[model samples]
Target: MRTVDEIFNEALTLPNASRVLLVEKLVESLDFDEDITHIDEAIQELWIEEAQKRIDEIRSGAVKAIPGEEALAQVRRLLEL
Candidate 1:
């Protein structure tokens, strides 16, 4: 029998579309006795949407941006650097 790593390596060689389908099947196979909670799924979706909105705002310059060095310096100051 093929080891898990060998199976994973073989799966990696599949085309993108095929790989996506295989992944979906693999995830579905994990649902044995426990069914997914709808509320948890909805909360996860909301978090994804909120993150996308924040990313869009930053990209569109709607939110003020800080330089990485400045942010790091502020963090270091908070840590008593």
Candidate 2:
């Protein structure tokens, strides 16, 4: 059987339209619980709200922004990697 990385690399080479159809078919195959739609909506809404709060905090100088590379380095240190 083809490994996941092999399958993924093959998928990446498809035209954009075909790649979209492939993704739709793959998601359909998962056949998630009917309640997953509602759960996904709630999760997305929470993330949107969280993003807005962060934006407001940064604008108000309540929080300072750091470079993404610096943040990633801090995370790697905390994880001891």
Candidate 3:
């Protein structure tokens, strides 16, 4: 397995947009267990549960939503674009 630095260095060599897409594909293709075929389904269910939890938190005023434009601008700044 590659170390984090090695992986990051490799990722950095990819074009910016390609790196983002590659990361998205890598995340989507992650396998939790070689012995478990249902791992992706399990992860999907967990994500749904976590999303619902966040929704509940927002409903209860425990979390605040950021505006879409503001979030986009922040990301643009972070990426220096």
Candidate 4:
């Protein structure tokens, strides 16, 4: 019954690559478990809020959007496709 912060702190102490792998596994396994629905809902709400903040930044000219071609090229390079 560890708190999220405690779990996160423990994960943070892992090596950088292992921490990333742990996060990836956690994300992949995040199915709709009935016991953790409330926690999942809170996480989703935070994601929405962060997305809204990014949108607001773009609207306020605080962040610039990448051009489509440049973005596509970067994606292709990352995917090695």
Q: Report lDDT (CA) for all predictions.
A: 0.83, 0.87, 0.84, 0.84
| TM-score to native of every candidate shown | 0.41, 0.57, 0.49, 0.49
Which 10 consecutive residues of model 1 have the lowest summed lDDT?
A: 72-81
Model 3 alpha-carbon drift over 4 Å, by segment = 1-37
1-81: candidate 4 lDDT, tens digit per residue: 999999989987877667667878988896765589788799999999999998999999999989999998886665452
Best by TM-score: 2
Higher-ranked by lDDT: 2 or 3: 2
Tell me the lDDT of model 3 at 50.
Answer: 100
Best-to-worst order by lDDT is 2, 3, 4, 1
| Residue 35 Cα positional deviation in candidate 4, in Å, after optimal superposition | 0.8
TM-score (C-alpha, index-matched) for candidate 1: 0.41
lDDT of candidate 3 over 1-81, digit per residue (tens): 889999899889876667878888998997655766477689899999999998999999999989999999887775553
Candidate 2 C-alpha lDDT tens digits along 4-47: 99999999888766777799899889867556988889999999
Off by over 4 Å in 4: 1-18, 25-34, 67-81
- Best by lDDT, which number? 2
* Candidates' RMSD to native: 14.7, 11.5, 5.2, 5.4
